[model samples]
Target chain A: MAHVISMLPVRNEAARWLRATLEQLSILTDRIVVFDDASADDTADFCKSYPKVRYYRGDIPWFEQNEAELRRHLWELATYENPEWILALDADELFEERATLELPWLLNQEDYDAVAFRIFDFWKGTEQVRIDGAWNPWNRFSPLLVRYDSTLSPDWMAQPIHCGRFPLSYRDRVTFYSHLRVQHFGWARGDEHLKKYLFYRERDLAVYGAVQSHTESVLSSSITLEPWIPMPSPGWFSEKEHR
Target chain B: MKKRIAILTSNHFEPSGARQVYGGAERYGVELTKLLLDMDCDVEWWQVGDNWNKEIIPGVPIRGVPETETPYQTMPHLNQVFFEQAVDADGAIYFVMYLAYPTVFPNSISISHGIYWDHPGMDKFLPSALDRQEWHRRLQLAIGGVRSVVSVDTATINWVRATWPILAQKFSYVPNFVDLNSFYPQNKESRSPHPRLRVVFPRRATTVRGINEAGKTALWLTESHTDLEFHFVGRAHDDNMERTLTTWASSHDRIFYYWLPPHLMAELYRFSDIVWIPTKSSEGTSLSCLEAMASGCAVITTAVGGLCDLIQDGYSGLLIEPTARALADATKRLASDPQLRERLGTHAREVAETFSLDRWHSRWSEVITRVF
Candidate 1:
């Protein structure tokens, strides 16, 4: 049996959708490593309530100011658990229900070092994902699940804004592009869209000297939306299937 | 100290005298400068011309950089030159979206009027598959380099998003607007009683504007309907096109060809019952269409570019394909039904309120405020 640990970098998300995220993550992993980035809300207490969650709060806010440093800290904390695999995710992201069934098979495999999944950006509500224009998130694969390797040192993109999740060296290793999807409800609410827009205007402009173009597109009214369709996990790791 | 802003464009003047190149893009540039001026920012306009400098308006100077054309397009050269010239400025604005290709300055924004390559004639511009591929590559670099983009229509935004989904966050849709006060409908009591139904084609005589189709449709409708009057109320690109239009108008009864200044166009729209904006390709949210809608004229426009954003198929105005036969059919239908015209005109005016100049100013000011 292999132990799988899920690491999450979260901020003031207690009042939003943090609990629902924790509830879903608890079902998939043996232990959940949560690094709260100086959240002002009851996120630390909420996360502490979970038996599987090992919660740690930063002394000062760092996610918006120094994302790479924060992610590096989260990575170090997750590695301390001696888990076979680490699943890096945001507080607003949730894996599909099929991921629970697929995770055991995925962990038992020795052919791949990492796994990538298509992400769906849910707009206005949880039932539908935005498919129009730049909202086509499913077209690109995000490497969220990676096998732990102690020999190779992880290098993060040292920018405060748009610093990617996972080590910069993750692409060098073989990665399986999994069919399982991640539902990102970060931009699901209308008010949250405005809040995010203003947040980027303040943080990105101050740090990067320019607000990212996608920040302006968050509030677009003329977007094409499609209902969320659940994809059945490929039974590659089942008893009947052989590599 | 006022924040200094430099704007790079292809053309604002006609490369010679102080005479401004009157077009939708030029109008947008002027309006954007005015807004920046109101925000107390020192603004300057740079364009490809024969090295001249003059003030287009009070407190705003327009300078011309020597024209340099490359095989790919003149855009990359213009962007590089503008970046060098505007280095001292606090920030920059790429007035034309394509001009930001290959590179752009930090703390800069770009403006996309609409999708200009949707026309069939784009083959002549790109010529080869390799040329188009290179063009697309440069365009992606241009868009990625800019901090933000202000798109006049959703058409260009959608195209960019579909082409490069990663760059979707860069665009903000801000459609063109009309001055409701200047372009209001005439009261029924004030309008002079006229027997003939007046139909106006108030657009520049250019191939992309669907002038040939409009001319054919106007001629057909005039010959068929005894009580219909067709008016061509815009300037031609050159003397040859003007001569062609004048000759066509001379041979037909109830047909008129004339040009009016921007201020006087309100009166022309007020008297007209139906407006035709049959643009074949390369369009944004047209100023002419918005003015017509604000003036309560039932607009019949082709579903090209941002025209779709302004006129819903049967709600505010009639939308059709850019063909002479389609234009003729829509015109004939409107000419026969006065009640339908009135209903569409009223709804158009109502829709025009949402795209008021005040709203446009507020939206644009918000975008510029973040950058500057």
Candidate 2:
């Protein structure tokens, strides 16, 4: 059994994003599998730059089968790696520098089979910019981090778009931490981001045969812990300025 | 002679800024769907999701492509199966451009919710680096197959006709009309206490809507005139607007900025003496202007785009050029003249009767019937 680790799935993305993902994960895991899902641009070539990166052409024959194939690919990776744990992410998702450095120690623990990390989704380049306030707390996505051999069952027809489906028995073995967060870099500048979004949105509609509303997908589903609370920019605004 | 009328939308009650899915569009759509149901016409509002509860609107049937939560990136994939579900509608209006929506259907009519000029230098003011040119190209290409173009204002119709002359032949003009009964003078809280000569600005806090210029004009009005109160409405939660207004408000006691619920907005108009709009960008006839006018408020709007059609300079209300000095002077003059305010307010309210809800419903119903 190979102790293989997979780096989620990706499509057309800039080389810089790929660089950030690789650099963040270099110290934590040795086995790196990169799934290339028919990128129109040079995303596949960019992934090949890293020596340890294992690239696979997405098995979906047409755009309609993209989602099924993507979900199945993750299952396949889990079965093949059979490692202690499996880390899943999109191309835009990045492991923060602090979390990346500390991941090895966290993974070595025996109590938690799947580890959950706090994710601070900064508006991509807002970290260096002074124009906007601190990152928005309302914009966060959470998914399960499980052991490689875990049997995961997903209910694809429900909420939490990507992570709507999870194994019922694996609930008690998972743990979430606040110190480490997945830095999702999906929202960048320009039409390139919109192009990717539009492409994925269209692909989703084609496969599913309808528009899945965000309100139902996020707010009304079983996955929602509570009603969406309007949280102010936690770190950006002072208590006085919050009102 | 029952007909199928479909209103294409991404979803209802979402935060999208499109007129159909947001604000008055949803109300208008609901009203239109109800009207069609009464007429025994088959009406369906289609989108990608299943958030729309069947019992939300009684009697009117709502259909969706599917309740899909797939992680596919493109929009066409979501509705590839649902596009087969389109009934032969007498008329169909694509409210906002979802990828491949217009192209998916066979024979139908599309109404222009708004036009994107794709102004080459629009990015100079807009913060987003998204290619306006490409957005415009795709928008124009998508609507190319529509049977005819229906624009709410002459400016949008003229711009599209002139920019793409080939498509001009199919242009139809239908001014935006408001429900007079829903927005007319109500026995709401008695008009705002005119403790001081009240000046209200109800536009978005963006450069596109000329909020900066309006702010500068407000500053000039307050500095030059002592007995005036300035009120700014709409999206006060915006960070940039908050920052700018906070600094300005500290020095000026009379200037107030805050957002009010839409229902309460009618009360703001009922009490205000004058409504000032100093917008620099494109505006499909503003519903706010019509509402203010119907509630008997003198409107001081710039002579740009649809505002020109609404305000007849010195007659209905002042039509000043889009400038800080010009708007400031106009406000000052309106502040001094109580008689002019009363006259303009009365005329403004009277003229608004033409665009009342009954009139608009009749006009829209006529379109649906013709197509059927």
Candidate 3:
């Protein structure tokens, strides 16, 4: 069996839904690697309580200044385990229940090296996902699970923000977009939305001269939300294994 | 001694840096450079860039000139700059015809890819009647100034002949070519049967290439037929356009979007069963269409620009107007009828043989012998 490892980055996520996130990840991943970005709270203690998780803390905060560096550090720590596949996720994101059943067959396939899934951003409540403007992550595919190749050197983007979790070099490899969904609960509450908006205004204003439209759209009153619906299982999942 | 030649164009690499551009024009430049090298000529390419120099291909140095913009068109200024810079070369080749406008050098040739002003939206660029007339006057001067004008299709030659009868003598109709060995039908015995019929649109994601129309048609066809798959295999001009196409493809299970370089395109064409070339305007003998035809894929193209010269309605391939409805109807017809696809694909391969790279090299050599 191939080992599936999950690498997560955290910052003051103990007060948030970190426990629920870890519980969900425990069902799908063989081991969970958590990197705390010098959180002020006891997020390190909370994460270390889980038996599957291996915790590490940064000496100094680096998420706001440079995201690519933080992700590279986490990647180096995750690769030390010699995992077959690495799933990069955040502290607030969780794969739906169906992923536990569908991912085994996907990982066993030899054709594709990376798997991209549709991400849903839950807004205001946990039952609904945002669909208006750029909040609609279901419109695009995001590659979360990648087969770790030791021979190729991974190159990270130099940007301070919006730098992807996986190396940009994985784009040239064959990627399969699976019909799986990852639910994000970062914006599920009202207070956290305000804090996120303020954080962007502080960090992103220096990088981008003007406020990004997607950032502004998050606070718009005329937002649209759709109920969360799990995708049906693929036909191959039910077929009998010949071997 | 080898003949020294200078080639001038607007862009060989992306303006941002030294990245090689991927499109029909860039492919033509590569093929032309190879032909020139085979004829024992020393060639160099010059384009608008940030004064950086690099090699486009081995032994072919691509020099960049700092770009300048004017209130009017910037190409004429770039042309003068290139002419002044390459004054000592034996001859020059204007990769784009309009770049030679209002300027001329001795022993020079110009190439017209196709008519670019055929689209309805061109009125916004040249708004008045006098503006349109002045545009024609500039084109006339450009054609008269060059020693020879090599056009990729007869549509451009016919348009020039109707506009200025005297300049018709200078025009040479040399349509684009494809390598038959690289792009050919996959053998029937080796072919693996799949459930879904793969249809491909192998052009850039641009308005003039009719990506919007093809995208709309793809949505309709995928919704109507469950056993059909649509693949878009080309790059977009910008990140936003690429994102839009990616989003659309992601929303549908049977649709896919990706890009490949020129060498890998042959394999993709062979994998595809049907090819769509729904060009709205501003097209030459599109290299994608030629490659797809050579790969023995049943092509459905609009009768726009040089596409009219390549595909015959109901014979070589299905020809129709540039519209989403027309594209959808043709795709639906080709999807249900496999025999029609095989017959059209067979005829398309036969037609493609007439436009092989060997013939193109010979024709270009004849023209080069006369001018250089």
TM-score of each: 0.59, 0.51, 0.65
Lowest summed lDDT window (length 10), candidate 3 chain A: A234-243
Q: Considering every candidate listed, which one attains the maximal DockQ?
A: 3
Q: Report clashes for each candidate as comma-separated counts.
A: 4, 30, 0
Among all windows of ten consecutive residues in candidate 1 chain B, which has the lowest summed lDDT? B13-22
Model 1 has fnat of 0.00
Q: Give the range where candidate 1 chain A is weakest over 10 consecutive residues by summed lDDT.
A: A234-243
> Top lDDT: which candidate number?
3
Model 1 alpha-carbon drift over 4 Å, by segment: A1-243, B68-70
CA displacement after TM-score superposition, residue B230 of candidate 1 (Å): 1.8
TM-score of 1: 0.59
lDDT of each: 0.80, 0.56, 0.82
**Docking quality level of the chain pair in candidate 3:** incorrect
Model 1's alpha-carbon lDDT is 0.80
Which candidate leads the pack in TM-score?
3
DockQ of each: 0.00, 0.01, 0.05
What value does the lDDT take at residue B169 in candidate 2? 68
| Candidate 2 local lDDT, A1-243, one digit each (tens) | 224365556666655477777655554566667776777778877778877677776644322344544655555654565666667666666765544433554454333355554344433253521121223332322444666544455323322234322344444342322224466555444334455556657655755666455312322223212111111111111211222
- List candidate 3 segments past 4 Å from native: A1-243, B18-20, B68-74
Which model, 1 or 3, shows the larger lDDT?
A: 3
